[model samples]
Target: MTLAFDSAGLGPGFADPVFDSQSVFRSVLNAVAYPGAIERLAHRPGAPEGLDPAMASVVLTLCDLDTPIWSDAALSSEAVSTYLRFHCGAPLVAAAADARFGLIGDAAAMPRLDAFAMGDERYPDRSTTLVVTVPSLTEGPQRQWSGPGILRRRTVAVAGLPDWFWADWALNQGLYPLGVDVLFACGDAVMGLPRGITVKE
Candidate 1:
């Protein structure tokens, strides 16, 4: 519902916006820099019924007035839409490919990596960044990934994503600088899966 959600009505975002957002932003950067590494969110913000703290923290930190956002059915509730609009002031796009930021509360049923915007050759940085909410980041079958941030290889076990995700990921990674980047969140933890990282089944 609301933050503090208590009688006082603390509000619906980081208690301390500046400090909290910086912390979460740093965590996000670190997660992306070191693929497969799990980063726990220190700031737990109040969010809608279907949204979790990790996803909330991410949206509050990354999405802004200039970005276009898209969400799957699992996160397309009126409450969630209201929360995103109120907190981020970002426009909600109808198609995933039109969004600069995509939010998925149901990773199992989410669209393929190709469904989202893959920045064109010249402006590869314009690609969409997907915030995917999963069941757990510490439990499940592990996949080995190696890339820019990783020294050699790192193993990660993110539970709940469908098998097709990994398959689609291979193609995504193959696109290198042209594909979408992903942040896998569960509870208060987030794991990054940038475009450079290659995951071996």
Candidate 2:
């Protein structure tokens, strides 16, 4: 038997794979370390048609053959799956609970936060890291945030999230160290919201 490969809608990966991944990794690290602070990713991943540049960059930087990724319907195109498999070598999984990373292309229609892997009490690091695409990182209803990585409460505004997002987030936070971490991608900007963080309108 023979298998045919399709490259019709594939896009370019990192220009300098090693160096580019390192740079983006540092930016992501800072975002997670600073919580509410927005970090800019300088390199563009030349992602496929349906993927966001920032989201694509995160996948390229963090995922590998060992990571299982799950994507919402809007981002689950063949082009995207092929692009990620070729570039990041990450496997796409059907269930969010089995994914180490989850991508939400349409935040407004995103699934409930509890649907993802919340890890276990003995190994919280096993939880999923959700990368959600949003309209703008700086133009929405403001919310107050405080917790580890934050010295004091900070106000942040993010556009394109679902109406019950914050409420769901609060419930997720109640799970303590077992809940998933979130990364918001808006254009070239990215922000992190670790499990321990507190968010309020």
Candidate No. with top lDDT:
2
RMSD of 1: 3.9
Model 1 C-alpha lDDT per residue in residues 1-201, reported as the tens digit of each score = 765522232237889999999999999999998989999989979987889789999999999999999999998787888788888889999999999999998888998889999999899999999999999887878888888999888888889888888888899998887999999988898989999889986
Candidate no. 1 TM-score: 0.93
Question: On residues 49-161, what C-alpha lDDT tens digit does candidate 2 reach at each position?
Answer: 87999999999999999999999999988888889999888999999999999999999999999899999989999999999999998899999999998988989998899
User: How far in Å is the alpha carbon of 178 misplaced in model 1?
Assistant: 0.6
- For model 1, name the residue pairs that clash: none
Q: Give Cα distance to truth, residue 94, candidate 2, Å.
A: 0.7
Residue pairs with backbone atoms closer than 3 Å in model 2 (clashes):
none
Tell me the TM-score of model 2: 0.96
The most accurate candidate by TM-score is 2
Give the deviation of candidate 2 from the true structure as CA RMSD: 1.6
Per-candidate TM equals 0.93, 0.96
Worst 10 residues of 1 by lDDT: 2-11
Prediction-by-prediction clash tally: 0, 0
Residue 174, model 1: lDDT of 88
